[model samples]
Target chain A: MSQSTVPARGAARTSGTVRIVGAGLLGASIGHALTALGVDVVLSDTSPAQLRLAVDYGAGRPARGDDEPRLVVVAVPPDVVAQVIEQELADHPDAVVTDVASVKLEPLHALRARGVDLTHYIGSHPLAGRERGGAISARADIFIGRPWVVCRDAETSSADLAVVEGLALDLGATPLEMDPEEHDHSVALVSHVPQLVASLLAGRFVTAPEGSLRLAGPGVRDTTRIAASAPELWVQILGSNAEPVVEILDVLATDLAAVADALRHPDAPGARRTVADSIRRGNEGVERLPGKHGQNRRFAQIVVMVDDTPGQLGRLFGELGDLDVNVEDLRLEHSPGAQFGLAEISVVPSVVHGAVDGLTARGWKIASMPND
Target chain B: MSQSTVPARGAARTSGTVRIVGAGLLGASIGHALTALGVDVVLSDTSPAQLRLAVDYGAGRPARGDDEPRLVVVAVPPDVVAQVIEQELADHPDAVVTDVASVKLEPLHALRARGVDLTHYIGSHPLAGRERGGAISARADIFIGRPWVVCRDAETSSADLAVVEGLALDLGATPLEMDPEEHDHSVALVSHVPQLVASLLAGRFVTAPEGSLRLAGPGVRDTTRIAASAPELWVQILGSNAEPVVEILDVLATDLAAVADALRHPDAPGARRTVADSIRRGNEGVERLPGKHGQNRRFAQIVVMVDDTPGQLGRLFGELGDLDVNVEDLRLEHSPGAQFGLAEISVVPSVVHGAVDGLTARGWKIASMPND
Candidate 1:
């Protein structure tokens, strides 16, 4: 079914009301975005305050009657996402429903084994979020341009897919259709595994001596930034996506073992080869990544200095644009001495030389480019 | 000795010169930075064109007399870095010298075993570079505000340390003192291991079916950007830093195994715990990283969109400054659609809400914050 076949405004009549079961970040945000588009949204939450906050935030109005909505989006904590989805399916049999959860396969399988109505329900995960949570944080364009993966099973009706896809488009997001297994596996590699690696690295420093962490720099930050996410939330995500995530981590472990053995004895030529092989592999991995706008496939570096002032760095970027150098990537390092900061700018190799020269000529001191 | 006691400009000493043998990217860049600071620098390279290019680039002039410079920096491909450092040291006695190779312990041991003058020699590596190579790519500020690590040993003299530190300082870099072993180990964890992981992930796609890579996004790019580096250069670096790198990879591998197992059997409770543990650990690791400018550590997510217009982004940032939000970190995702891009803005969480509201109120469409 095309989007035009659905109601143009205030929710689709055929689907009844669109009831948002939880008033948290995802649910409330969805309500807000949909409401802004003039959809009839009714929000229900266990917490009266949260529900009111959702309404206040313009996500939706409180449910006034027992009338079942055509669609119910269950957006709760991951551990509870499956339960909420299951409960909603039971509570409102006629409503075509879905979820916005990180992990999908297990939830789908659980519902399948329990023989929940598969035609009216689909699984979805909008690959977006922040460190903060709640309805107050909701925005209308939250999913804009992000990938919203829809997990479709054999029993999923064409109408179900259309509803989810329409929702994605409504929020300015792209819909990516995939099987539950593929979705789980892909996220395991990209999201779950990476999150674990970051957390493991970050955890190492929790027990470190004082000065040791003082030396931690941008690399560590880049590697572990995701680790700073809410622990309870992650537990839910990892718990649901355990299998695929573990598989990738296992592969990493095997590689890690080889590397460790080599490090213990570098005199052996084979050890050197092992180490070189790994680094080479990493180099290759980095290259496969798409460049800015998915144009070039090479990674660029951005380096700049941070000053003590509150907004000095922000202004520096403003200046960079005046120079017309498109920065592909950036990393920052603050020097030990007072009053100095360093920002690394990674751009296309084609523009690196010019950007360096331009920035230097503009009177902004360039920090780490090689000197000939 | 305090920096104040060191002569602001060492008397234009006629003392023996520092012979930089390779005149390639690392060699020439070092020479250029040094020459700009009035250090007596002599440039040499196997390629005459490269030698001339070094001169044109202002790295240094050819050595005029037979007198060996007080220091010799052998900046060559990793495969030849050790050989070149040995050759240069053999050619220059009574001169304090160092090699700016990425890996350290091996070369230091190699020199020791070969009976090179240890008293005047140290193993040093400046944690800096670009994907491009050669003299033309060099910049005088290559090491400025970057870490120039001096790997010391019993043979390394205080004077040698001072000289290397001076070079780093003059180049506007931070001089870090470390034992050769410690330096190798630290870099293995921070640099070499990351390189390998990136490569391995990228290599998975080197043989990917056609068009599969076109769908690659920022996650892949961020993970694989370092893969585009010169392969031969990395071979040498990994070869030298093999032992420690391998060791770290082993630890990582163990973590990977646990993750893999969890993925393979999601229903198993232990698997869930393992995944959660990994993520938690990553969170801890991320927190250990030092904040920019030695300030309170906080993370900022920057969101922005790129329009097809050449400088539309430039204008957006130019306007950002007027709103008074300090952008601590920024990431832009390129989508295929016309007239739209995805920009994620990370600022101090304390101010991110205000910034988002400010941007939205200004009619700039903002992506939903993660929590939202």
Candidate 2:
């Protein structure tokens, strides 16, 4: 129900219909964005109920028999992506087809081995999603400001490439180009490998004593949060993106063994140094993370204490608003047993002193000084 | 600067001075809590400036030559905990002494090997802390609702055990009893090993290409957050609790290898099943975690879309207050480039429909359905 005020930028679409072959979250959301941009769109799916839900959500209407689509977007699970793309290309000979599967190279290889015409097909993946599925969770603004990588090869025509890039732009996303294999390896490093690691670490707690878990703090809670992600979906994602993920996990297992051995014989020569160096590398690794607006600049955080009651956070933010201190980011830390919560507000360095002074004057308790 | 309205819930202690041997975060915070409960607290540290800072913050006064302390708390680094406890026991022959080091067995063994009298000494660890250290980050309520594990042997006198438990209670902590070895193994499982795993995982990111790092999401971010913890401090913790942590890490390394091998050869016997079983085990592990108030009950979350401007979050929370929705927990998500943020408010299931309908009627955009 929210709207973006940023105007669309790109060459005019010159009137064409885009047909989407799936009615899941991504497909419906794509249709919603294209429809908003004045492009005639059609949605098709195997399940009539799912197709109707997407249509009712204003993604698109049922496909018309007489329609001639210029672009066919295949939005489906990774395992079926290659088969769906092959079929769509056959169904609409002139349309440039693209499949939004997470694993690009595997599907490309599948289609290539089947001897399909590769000139009109491109592989693309939008790095925006939710833990839940279905059209009910779909939103037109899900991809805004997110990266949508398009996989292009030598055979992809310039005109076809522009159409895909234009669609990404119209959906308020920044489209970047990468080869299929490169995209797979990048996501494996960032996404798939992390998922497996989180799962494996969380599995350790399954048989733990209740009393031991009573001592579980924020550190353990955070390090295992992603383990709650839907396993069925991840099974498919990991299965298709297997090779690169396996490679990363193998390397991580080796490092894990090294740390274990060092801890086992801490008195051995250079053992403590090995432990220290491993942790230091972690320090350097986290520092490479980009800050606000993709800049390397870090913001300072000011913590204020608030009671765990209605309107407490609202009143705190209101006081901050009166002081004209723009909060760049905010994190709330509280447990159900605690009677109060701490609101950590991030702001640029220049305004921190003023913000702290103003909040303290307003009777807000300062918990800690500005920290990175 | 804030005060807890919840009255202290322990037997009235009409007592003499309690001496604290360190003036850092934990030492000063314990002094602060005991002082609030009408206990005479004497503080001492090697650094005069640090001692004065703790005193200025009302944690305690400087120790006096004629003073007689009934209890002495040794709150120092893990590596020096044994030496500090020995010195404290020697100084206060008639007093009961406890060391608040993270690892328990190492210090106990060191004192036993040194032939120190064991009747008046207890090893304890309060599972409460902040990422930052020093008197500046000290809080009186840090121990509230947290587990304080007291390690007592057969030689520990009833009077000394009661005094230690009383100290834990006076600080608003739930005191649980365990042997030194059991306490060490428990913490190694819950705290120390997770720290190593997080650091090792984050260490991999140090040399990652910029493009691969760009794809990092909340999953990777949460799994590696504790990697930013102070490395020198953790090196000592892991070294002190080496046996259990190393044992767990070794087992985890084996499991990681199995998952990797399975992913590498999905067609091999039971390979796909192994991957799914590993993920399923993670789900079971997470389900074992207690929910709010240390109960197994789960709460439903109400997500409301908030605009990126000042006062938007305040307005939404203010509306929730008017509707009498008690927010159990809250999380905020937004990217710097996005025009809006989402506030995920957790509430009890019985009130979820009411909260959703009330917020929706008041013009709030619902992003997702209620989730645990």
Candidate 3:
């Protein structure tokens, strides 16, 4: 990835050599961004091939014997995170150590049980992940605009906490301070529970008749998209955050049973009300998600029908540019054998009027123009 | 919606006057497509406001008593669908009648219990729906490239089935023949069950701490997108098709409990295996979805980092046209305050190499290039 021309605020906040314990996706991405900020980064991993691949990709240089890192960031998977943090703290006595595991309390509890020194360790998690993992899929901008939670307690000094926070800042992530318990509970609700639910729902499709799947539309596809996740990885994440996840799923099961009971005897008193309340609660829940549904309201969409041939879209987009309309998002939909395709373009509401008028002036078929 | 310039195959397959019993989204959409094919269409609805809105939108004209329809299509909600179908059959004795309700068995069973003459009646479902309903959201192309299920019996004549199948073909839908029992069971797995699961999962988020939702990403968004559906509409759909839906949810609840038990005791023997199997089965189930993940496998993606400025996207799209590469699908992701946006463009696998090289040669920053 090329470095941006924008001025970076990273080098001022973070300095000296940094060591990354795992040369996987998160580790290599941190190295890429830090290296772009003109910082010295050293990366190491158990697999020699993976380490070499990350190093060869300019993530960092090979570890050297004389190198004294100011910070040691452990980016190992969940199962080994506690052990790695314990070892890193022992090896780098003078350095502040932080591990970016999803569940915070589990590893902290494991290290506490082992009687490891707690003064220099902080548990953190970046709420960012891709379907594909490893250095091959790593990008410097993976963490931009994502929430990275840093966990600290009475044992942590402000300076040590700053080191971890600075690392998050230099990588263009918003650092949110959360205690270990709060961090684990939050992720359990958002990430771990959703993963388990997707798996459970998609599992039902395994034995479904072929005719049932033939009727599959965008609705079912959207619900099961995350079901294609790596199974082994999810099992660890779910297991580590079991208490909070199980607590939520238990309540969700109660809801499921209530709906099922209502469906079984729809004529019973309050049966229809039970089913309606389930859906109404779901609507309120999704709307409660910050910044999720706001995206649709922030931008207005206009659909234009264009010929499937080349240059047709180019002309429409070019006209949009000439009108000074900045398209915030775009989705192009066309059936496999259909002769026409629809370009659903999302632009800011203020520019939508001008954008539609400009495209219409250029002889474009306005299939559905935004009025707002 | 404007009429397409391409020659239509609809006029030959579907001719004579057609009557639509509801003026909602599906009814108006069907009317729009039929009117475009040179067929005389008459529309009627229980509400005068709904009828006026659809008629004003050029879907069709107001119904007249002297007008005789060759085909009558009912597009009402599931609860009253059977009553409407029976009335339509009696009113238009010479016409073949079909209903676009999502459930097939419920209406057919209701009609049979009433001892209504079954010779002129055939049950059908389009397997199509949108989040919003009513005439305000109707579109002529809603049914294109979607599966439409038509159910017929020994009492039905070939001419009647032909009339119903012609409606599907004229609207660019693939009409598949299935018995009423098969249609009900198939929809229960694909459409009805998924809706319940989404609502159930999202319902858990209602009481979550706001911090949890701040970490929400595309994964949770995708799984819960369908949860925002209208509760009143879903209540009827689920109630009418309760038998098959309850059957599927029963087995899914068992799978859920097994995983929850394993998560509560992760260190126990076979506990991890239960969790792994849950995820593994989900992966297999999603892979079994025909033409879903196949969309990604059919093309290769190349992500280009473009500055968030006017004309930047236009220039890149223009360059794509110059290279003679057809963009099959696209997704543009940008953080709110990020300095740059990533345009993930999908082109057919055969042309990915050329598109990447061409863009890189033209001085664009190719953040990630397609190797497939």
Candidate 4:
């Protein structure tokens, strides 16, 4: 087996090398980030074209010597991530290896079944992605600030865990230690199921009359944004995490039925109550949500008349810094005739009104005052 | 009976005055936009304080000299919108009177039953609002670029339609002519039902275990943002548009049930097919939605490592403009290390790779690339 000697722990870790297999988006990105940090990176890919693309993107040079690198990251499709990781382990017995797949349980199970060296293999899934794939799409900063879920069981060696965690740290991502099952279940609810819901909502418009679709606005766009995701990737995700995703869908179905019942029987005494109850529940759910970066969700709106002049709207937002109101949402509409524009700014609500009044008193023509 | 001489048809039309009966959010905003356009605006409200607030915000002066305004807008709570419109019609016989209520058919039917002069009464609903209410929240440009559904029946006169359309135009809103029934049905599917659905989803989080709520991000926030709206207003809207809203909900419920059945029996081939079908349908729905404004929906993720320094992240966005990549979405995650931050920039997929490469070449260290 290929081998290399490096300083043991406690010596200020100097430049070391990593071998990235499968020069795809994840692998190339890792190589790019590591290389930027003065780490020597050698990348290997089955496709010479992809390897060249990764190298061209500054991910790393093509693998050179038979010397074993300290780490190997197998960044391939979910179906092949496990196999590649196993192959890498057998090919380089000394290197700690990990796979950056979306799903963790199946890969971990595969390794367990194959009786791979428990100490060198760690399973990880970074909760981040884009719609496009391939080496050409790779970027160094993809993992920064996102959660890198590392699945560890009793068999996972502390040294391997440290290596994976160090890699996550190097990439500027939060390393979250979680059980494989828990990670799958959480994603099924927050990511997979929601994607289905968005897709379902968007699908309705596909068959809508032409005029009907033209009238569609930001609301529909926001709801169905995630529906544009890669279907093949989603199929694999939903297939593997089918149980939990289905469970969440079941809950959504029940809730939807209750709402339908309430709407159907509006004239009944309980109709209004049912509708209100559902709305109230929604309010509670919204309140439970964490705001930006774990902050409390702030709500606000700003209404300003937009002139037809180019860059006029941009200037308005720039001036908002004077108000110190964090704009959380915004909507703009122009009057039909020769008139000024109207822009509604939604912020944290705490300072939105004050900002409106401030701008109004400052010779900025206010559109409307707060109703209350 | 109050009467005024009508300006000669096709004569240089005199500037039309807008009379807002209640200086609430909608009323004050209408008055504000009209007054800003140098049109005569007269404001009135049961609460002198509210009326005074509207006037102070330059919405309009009080009605004067038994003057007959060309148009009267009844902007009040849903429960009173119809009554107020009827009263305004009685007081101003020559004015084209309309109501800005969320529900249309009920108010239109109520006026018809009251034997009000249908020739002069038009029903309109401005599909725009905020969670906050009152003149304090009113803005002149609130309706700009938003659809303002104007409902007309056989009894509506051309002159009346012209006046109402002019008012909508003056407010910088797109005037959509629809039958009252059709308007109600469309809104029930797109607006009212979605509100209820959001509320129901949000409610589920209210009783969730501690820390569960913290997991909510943009998805839940976006889905339930409207849920924070006034419950009482929704009650009136849902009650009035119960029929069509219920119909849509019923269909949704049927689909939901099918999905639920699929989830419950995942092992069964038929069940699996149903589940897949539902997901596929959802995907189709998502694809039909128009991108932001009229643009195609493009998604890109840029991972940038940020330091603790304030405004460093802001500079990155500013630099993105230099690269000529439009950022459509953004998310940030701070790792455990105190010194670094990761800002993920999601742009149109077409430009994501270029942007990432440009930034990396510029010497800003890259983090992790998003998995495709």
Candidate 5:
């Protein structure tokens, strides 16, 4: 248990006062994390109520006229990011300006089009956020253990880039440098396209009969979980990173068409092979995902039935602790109409048998043991 | 806590010995539930080891020569369902034979093509299963409150249909009747296609650069989680339900192409509107999904971060109990390289503020509050 508490990295490396514009999830969360690390943070937002809520939640203090911020974090929406960055650069001459909006290329192009001095402005995106937005959903640790991509160009100074990386580190995130084009394309493949695909797939459920939805299983729920995200925000995101996203979507659409056509004519020559190949490609794709801690190793899962009553899960965890079996990951599944929960605990493969035996001995119902 | 221990509902309604072929997840789960209800259950499988394991898990006893079964459950792989159902029906002449295969139409068509007697056979699919298969993963309560779709034809007698529905009820499932075509089309829309789409999207991650997946977030994880399902099994399911699934996939493919082309030429007329319209459609689609207890009403979510320790979650849940707030649903998010877990608790909208305030007062870090 003690080993689980790894030391919080990035505090000592992060120094100086920072000012954040926009009291939304990213900006406010950065404020909270910096404040927790004893770094002086001043928060500024156009929405006074939002600013007040962020301050009340211990995110940061209101900006003061005398405060000389060494770094200005422009955590605004994607569409308005470039304008805000331009404005921030003009307002704070000495401070390095960095924006946390998802897309980087559009903002850089916009800033370049406006002929703004680009040396002091660094484009960075912390790959961390929740479905819901605003300061109310902000967490100091939201960026912890996430990758923060810093889009740096040749014109950007090393000192300015260092400051932005320090900011990401201070918020407990890893900073990786990438060219704007590469970053945009990477996010399109990994993040942007996945989001749109989820939304589009979930859209199929809209006109489905209510009875059809009653048969919706975990597969459908998980596939569309992110579809519940705000569409207005996503429209802006997909709009900004349209090129790379569309490029990937085009390939996916073509593949889908081919697969559909093949399935349409299964009796056709090579149709079954095509179908099998597509699914096999999917198998290869999912296998590429890094496991917990980026190890890419498989863990055995033990599904235990948990009664709805409180302390049942507590008791289960307590027993697991007593058994000295570390849980690598945990997922609690509860269907809409079900009264109980299914606690799927992922643990090291070596400890599975012992964990199962111990739990069964304790009268805990082991619903499923996949590795068995 | 006491109220949560609702009496198991299916025991009193279930009667007679049920014979289940294929001691896998669905079959073993059915056997377990019926056995718990004090109804006799006879288990069979080609694999002696699987049958022994299911019997050891108390799912049921081995088949006896003189024992008579009132119901015959043919639970096997989708590709083998038709043959298995034929065998079960032929073996148990007086029994009402039903199958729990995911696809209904293909098997019915295959059986018709084989000229198998159809009078005692009823096609049913219980919308309950796990990503992993086999008896070891089976849960007696897997079908509780989930919809069980029964496909009836003109040859099916009313008494045989009632027996199948009664079996569904005995397993605590809501039985819904649909024609074979309707069932196949609906599952394709709600189940089969989602599975294929998930696989295809996850496949995109395979060729992605190593650094790109480092930026993978919850969206990517949720979208691809179902792709981890056994590929060989999925190949069979998609193959068996190929026609309807192909029809749905064709339409989806067309939509993807349109969205892609519109994104490709964003400056073209109506491109942005096309993008926004697609996302808006997704919002409407996800909004149609039922919430807990099949209600469409929304619930407020409160994300509370708990230190990653053995009893941390237990303590938090215990506190929730003290506050007397019933958790409508719960999901735990734990990332690698992090020392804490985020418990996203869903509750009635009215209780959101109080729950947040109470947990905060108890020194829990409320990472996000949906309702503010």
Candidate 6:
């Protein structure tokens, strides 16, 4: 089992030679970052064209077989990830190996099924992405300020784990250690299940009358927002982590049926309770999230009406800056043909009075809306 | 049967005495808007306290029994909406009666079953509200540019239907006409089903490990944002439109079960296809909705790295305004424990190159990310 303290962040967080397998978005981005930090990076990919593109983009030099890398990172599609990890482990036997695949348990389970050596292998995932892919779209700072999860197994050495964490720290990502099972389950609950749910909800609108779609408000907008993600990428992710995802989906489906049944006979005994409980449970569930709802309770929200004109919002924000009020969060709300938008600015309660006074003095109209 | 085009836009969209039967959020808001337009508003409510509050807020004057209203609007809880509408029509036999209940079919059906007179009654719903309720949170501009749907029956006269449409136009809402059945089914697809789906997805997180919850990202955030709605209020809504909502939920549950089954056996024949179809259908469905992933196709997104400082976002937006590029939509993204956030601002494609050049020239870091 691995046991290591988190790396102490300093002027330099990563060191020695690092090898990155795959020259796609994640892999080349890692190469570009490490090379910028003065680390020797050897990049590899099955596609000569992609590898050459990465090298041309200064991500890293093409991988040379003779090179002895201290660490190896596999960043390939989820379907072929385990095979790639096995190849990297055998090719660079002395190097600490990690793969930046979204799913952790599947690859480890796949490798273990074949009894492949895993002493040097670790699994990690960074929760960062863009609308595009490939080396041409790669950027060094894409992983900055995102969660880089590192999963270590019983066979992973503490030194190897630290190397992985060090890489995360160097990229300005927050590193958190989790076992493979924990990592998979966590993502299933937060990422994979939510994706399917959004898809299911959005799919309902496909056959809806066009007029109904026009009545869509913030509620449906927020719920189905993620349904537009690419199916190919999601299929791989959902397939790799099918067991956990299916477990969540099965329960979710059952719950939906229960609510439907309750609605079908709302006057029956306990029918109303059943429907209420589903929504109440949802309230409790969402509250467990890190940034729970009722955020307005902690941060005072000053609802300011902004005109649809170009500089109006800019001027409002600029004035808030002048008042030295750091807006913790903000939400923009508008109707289909409304000329004005409402900007709900969340600031610390202590500064709210001053913010309101300052905004009013600046001739801003603040709308008062209280919770029932 | 009523046959009429929508009311024409005019300087004075409403005239004569208007009576609102309930002083709740929607009712008081209508009263406030009409009162401001120099129209006589007669407001009534079962709760004297609420009626007084609305009156004190200048929403409307107290309803006098002797006064004949030109139009009567019923705004109350969904469970009692039909009962109130029946009473309103009987009390003001000469006035055109409309109710702002969310579900139109249930109330209309309830009224028909009771053998109530229907000639002067038209059902309507304004798709406008706030997190809060009652006159305390009411505003004159709440309905501005929002959809106001009017449902007319075969017994409705053209003059009465126009009265209802005029009410919508007076409140600055665009009125659309549909039969009660169409309105109910549309809301079920766009609003009710989505609400339940969000609640169902969020309910799964009730027992999730804290660590997993920390990995929550935009997908989960967007999907579960509405799960915090009041359970009591939702129970009534779900019950009132149970037939339509249940129909949608049944199909959604069936779809969910199929995807779950596919994930359980991803390698089996046609399993991956099932999963892929679910997501593909989602893509098609969300495309039917007004926004997207389609938003991405329309607007070029410029992601700028912003320091978590007071003036960083303000400066970015101000600079965008200076470039004369109006940001169509925006998203602020950051990870826990990160010192900087990424502001993804969507701008019209025509202005993207110029906006990006301006931002880059102003020393803003724009990260390039491509679709995978």
Q: iRMS for model 2? A: 3.3
TM per candidate: 0.82, 0.87, 0.93, 0.79, 0.88, 0.89
lDDT, each prediction: 0.67, 0.79, 0.82, 0.68, 0.80, 0.81
CAPRI grade of model 6: acceptable
Please, what are the lDDT tens digits per residue for candidate 6 over residues B316-344? 77777788888766767655556566777
- Give the local distance difference test score of model 1: 0.67
Residue-wise lDDT of candidate 2 within B274-295, one digit each (tens)?
Answer: 8888788877776666534233
Which of the numbered candidates is closest to the native, going by highest TM-score?
3
lDDT of 4 by residue, A168-227 (tens): 867656678887887776676556666666665555555655444534555555555666
Regions more than 4 Å wrong, model 3: A1-12, A305-315, A334-341, A348-367, A370-372, B1-12, B306-311, B336-340, B348-366, B370-372
The better candidate by lDDT, 3 or 4, is 3
**Candidate 4 residues B246-355, lDDT tens each?**
77767666766666566556666786566566567766665554434233234545666655453454355445656776654445554333355556655667776777
- Docking quality tier of candidate 5? acceptable
Model 3, TM vs. native: 0.93
TM-score of candidate 4 against the unseen true structure: 0.79
Winner on DockQ between 2 and 4 is: 2
Candidate 4: where is the Cα deviation over 4 Å? A1-15, A19-25, A42-55, A61-67, A80-89, A109-119, A133-136, A267-269, A293-372, B1-16, B44-56, B61-67, B113-115, B209-220, B260-284, B291-372
- Evaluate candidate 2 and give its CAPRI docking class based on DockQ: acceptable
Worst 10 residues of 2 chain A by lDDT: A1-10
Q: Write the per-residue lDDT of candidate 1 for residues A135-173, one digit (tens) a residue.
A: 876766556666788877787788777888888877766
lDDT of 2 at A36: 67
Write down the worst ten-residue block by lDDT for model 6 chain B.
Answer: B1-10
What does chain B score (TM) in every candidate?
A: 0.81, 0.91, 0.94, 0.82, 0.91, 0.88
List, in the given order, the native-contact fraction of each candidate.
Answer: 0.47, 0.54, 0.64, 0.40, 0.53, 0.69
| Ranking of models by DockQ | 3, 6, 2, 5, 1, 4
Q: Which of the predicted structures, 4 or 5, would earn the higher DockQ when compared with the native?
A: 5
Model 2 pairs whose backbones collide: none
* Candidate with better TM-score, 2 vs 5: 5
Q: Is candidate 3 or candidate 6 better by TM-score?
A: 3
Q: Which tens-of-lDDT digit does each residue in A1-372 have in candidate 6?
A: 001212222344667678999898899988877787678888999999999899998888987769998889999999999999898888888899899998998888899999998899889999766545788878876787668899887777789889998898777677889888898999999998988888888888888889889888777888887887888888999999988898888888888988998998777899999999888998888888764354446776677877767667778877888888887777776555566667777777778888888989998866543322
